[model samples]
Target: MSPYSQEVLKYLNLGIESELQAYVFYKKVMEKINDEETLEAVRKLAEDEKHHFLQLEDEYDKSVRSEMWAPYRDIMRKEGLPDIDEHISETHKELLARVDKLKTKREIFEVALELEKEAYELFAGFYEKTDDEEAKKLFQFLMNFEKGHVLTVENMLKNL
Candidate 1:
């Protein structure tokens, strides 16, 4: 594989891993909670995360074989610095610690809200930094989806 494809795979795999983690986390939360409303909400979120993971997986599969992969460019503004890596798994690890301690529906929704916001920021930063049109579009799509999750979480919190 070309260096460009390798770089793309790195980011795509990170995205896939993050979504999978989110799916598992949400599913676990749904399983632990007895409140039907909260259980249903978390179940839907888990499904959404699963859907996103599949989409990214498909993208990664196609990207590895496609000619659309572009050469690496400095997406970050630092004159000679490397592209900023989205260590979403690390962020999830931190959130998972806090999530494990939550004891209420409100607390659960609050954490979900924060996680969605963080995801939106991460993707938005990538969208802004990348010069590659396709990367920018992909980042934008992820960012927008995360933004919707933020809205959904906020609505869930309000209803709680």
Candidate 2:
């Protein structure tokens, strides 16, 4: 994999980790919110995160053949490490960590918005750099997805 792909992969996983945290956080927020609209908004954001997760998984899977880690994956593995698969679900743990960092509903939204915006820029920059049609298309799709997350969170906040 090229340096560009590696960079994009890192950013994509970052977003995935954030989204997992967002999903659980937002689900908790829904419990605190009595307004139907606010609850709906939270649920929508959760769904959007789930969608983004699936998209990233599909794209990442394409890069790794036969369901095996590619060179890029190996590079991310620490030196003298057991194997990348050992940390294969690192994103899951990351999400839990982020959730542990949050103590309030507003904090969850703030962290989620920050993560989405960063992800948008990261994917958008990658989309602009690549001339590969398929890669560009995938990145663009991700860019829109992240931006949509920002909008969803903002709307939820406004409703609250």
Candidate 3:
């Protein structure tokens, strides 16, 4: 496998894991929210994260796995690739720990805004780093979705 393919697989794995984390975070926040409007908005965000994860996973499967990327995986295993868990941000860890303690709409919106901003940055960085046209397009799509999420969360925070 080319070094490029290996790099894309690494990015896809990070993106997939991040999306799953975001989905879980939003769902947890939803449980603490009592307002119907806020809940609906958060639910939509969670669904978007789920969709992002599926999209990234599909891309990974199509791009790498179908073409015998397993050898690369084996090499990664032999070299002991760093765990995905270690890539999670400290802010996210803190938020997950305190999710249940978020008692007000403003507080919840603040957390949501932070998460959305982080996601936007993550995708933007990915988009910037990749030279492959297909990977660039995919990352750009994710970046656009994350940008919209940031806007939505910012609006929600403003209203609170």
Candidate 4:
């Protein structure tokens, strides 16, 4: 039995999928970038997406079962943990295709900014719909992080 409502679980799954897709997209974009500053910025964005995916996965596991959650926490606490599975879904492959089309630093940053804005909207909607304090807090945290990413990407675009 899950602790979260089915709707909550649905949102969590959406978040998990989106974050993983973003991480892969950023990773692919990093491969095309030659400028040191842009490469570093994109790398940071990839790292942030990876972290968000982990956090959302953790929350999902906890909602589903404690036994399923403990190993993840343990692994996360350990030194030199392995990277998350990089299985690209069909949807993710489409994202990668879009990333492949990006030809300039500005194009990359513009796409990133749009992605961050969408994430912010998603989190904001989830936060508004949830009455559960824990879920609300999680959504709020994600919203703040996404908002920050949007600002960072906007600034990067301006500098490009």
What lDDT score is found at residue 32 in candidate 2? 61
Off by over 4 Å in 3: 1-4, 66-95
Report the Cα lDDT for residue 32, model 4: 88
Candidate lDDT scores, in order, read: 0.66, 0.60, 0.73, 0.77
Residue pairs with clashing backbones, model 1: none
Better of 3 and 4 by TM-score: 4
lDDT of 4: 0.77
Q: Highest TM-score, which number?
A: 4
**Candidate 3 has what TM-score?**
0.77
In model 1, which runs have C-alpha deviations exceeding 4 angstroms?
A: 1-7, 65-97
Q: After superposition, how far is residue 16 of candidate 4 from its true place, in Å?
A: 0.7
Q: Quick one: ranking by TM-score, best first?
A: 4, 3, 1, 2
TM-score of each: 0.71, 0.61, 0.77, 0.85
Best by lDDT: 4
lDDT of 1 by residue, 55-127 (tens): 7766776667543322111122223222223453343576567667888888877877876777678667766
lDDT (Cα) of model 1? 0.66
Q: After superposition, how far is residue 128 of candidate 1 from its true place, in Å?
A: 1.4
Q: Please provide, for model 3 over 88-109, each residue's C-alpha lDDT reduced to its tens digit, 9 standing for 90 to 100.
A: 3343576578787888888887
lDDT of 1 at 108: 78
Off by over 4 Å in 2: 1-35, 66-104
Separately for all candidates shown, the number of backbone clashes (residues 3 or more apart, or on different chains) is: 0, 0, 0, 0
